[model samples]
Target: MNKQEIGTFLLRVMLGFTFLMHGLSKFQGGLGNISGWFQSIGIPGFMAYVVGTIELVGGIALIFGLGTRIISVLLIFIMAGAILYVKLPAGFMGNGEGTGFELDLVLMIIALHLGLNGSSFLSIDSKLPNRKRGQVSDKMAS
Candidate 1:
């Protein structure tokens, strides 16, 4: 693969893994704590479940390169909400540090990248059959 393709692959891999970990963490008591924290910050507790589900599902979709653009968009919203509701009040230091916006910022950037570029050539998305007839030429089919 060329440099650009390699870079895209690496970015997808890193973002996929990072998002997956964050989502997995939610199933293991992290979601409850985060939900409580959100409630403490005037956000509803139920929203935590919604966020957790999105992260988990979106992360998995990203890793598998399925519906990448849609998942990326959803994650973008999730990260944006996190920045607004959580990081904003903390003054970017992230709750007591210097602009705790680090994770949110990175996630937002990655999500935006995925939204724009979409899954790389190596992804399952590219390999999937085209829904539109006549789109796949005979040579490509062979």
Candidate 2:
């Protein structure tokens, strides 16, 4: 693969792996505790579950390069919501306790990049036939 392809692959792998771990942590009472914390912050408990499930599924999809564009877009929103609802009030430097918005900010940037560029050379979406590749017009001069 070219350097561009390699870079894309690396970005996807790192982002996907990080997100997957975050999601996995949730099911192990990490997310449940987080949900309770959200409730304390005035966020609805059910919404926390919804966001967690989205992160889990979207992170897996991103890792496998399956429907990458869609999953990436979804993750963008999830990260955005997290930043707005949870982190912003805590401030960028966090509540002076090291808990901060930096990680979420980085994830948001990565998700935004994925949403824009989509999966690269190794992705299933790239391998699949697109309309331009599969369809032929009858109004051909050839």
Candidate 3:
């Protein structure tokens, strides 16, 4: 419940919701187009499914504070790919050819922070009755 915890929770929720929406959009708006776009970008079409699943699942997990660090790591990889493959060519401001990598960079940084620090006491990981070593919880933090 400290400032850092509150900030982390906000970041976690924000990043999670963002990924959730993107993942949901990929499916709701039709993965066929996403798959085609991936293929066009030189990535395997099937990776669309993999990325979508990870985003959706990872988003939910992050929101609930379950496996926060692991999920954050996965999200970091996704953002990296996005920046490297798609957004970099678009320039920092998009330059009129799709969106830029700024947001991706931000998200990647958030994920990096989560991966390094883990989640707050409000997380399920923290609430677990018996936690493994290295896991941070309210009591453990105290």
Provide the TM-score for each candidate, comma-separated: 0.79, 0.80, 0.88
lDDT score of model 3?
A: 0.91
Regions of candidate 1 where Cα sits further than 4 Å from its true position: 93-99, 132-142
Ranking of predictions according to lDDT: 3, 1, 2
The alpha-carbon deviation from the true structure for residue 33 of candidate 1, after best TM-score superposition, in angstroms, is 3.8
Report the backbone clash tally of model 1. 6
Clashing pairs in 2: 26-31
- What are the candidates' C-alpha RMSDs? 4.3, 4.2, 5.0
Cα error, residue 75 of model 3, in Å, equals 0.6
1-142: candidate 2 lDDT, tens digit per residue: 7887777677777788877777777777677787898799788877768777777777777777877777777888877877887778778879875467888888878777777887667777777756585567565535
* Prediction-by-prediction clash tally: 6, 1, 0
Whole-structure CA lDDT of model 1: 0.79
Sorted by TM-score (best first), the order is: 3, 2, 1
Indicate the TM-score of model 2.
Answer: 0.80
Measured by lDDT, the strongest candidate is: 3
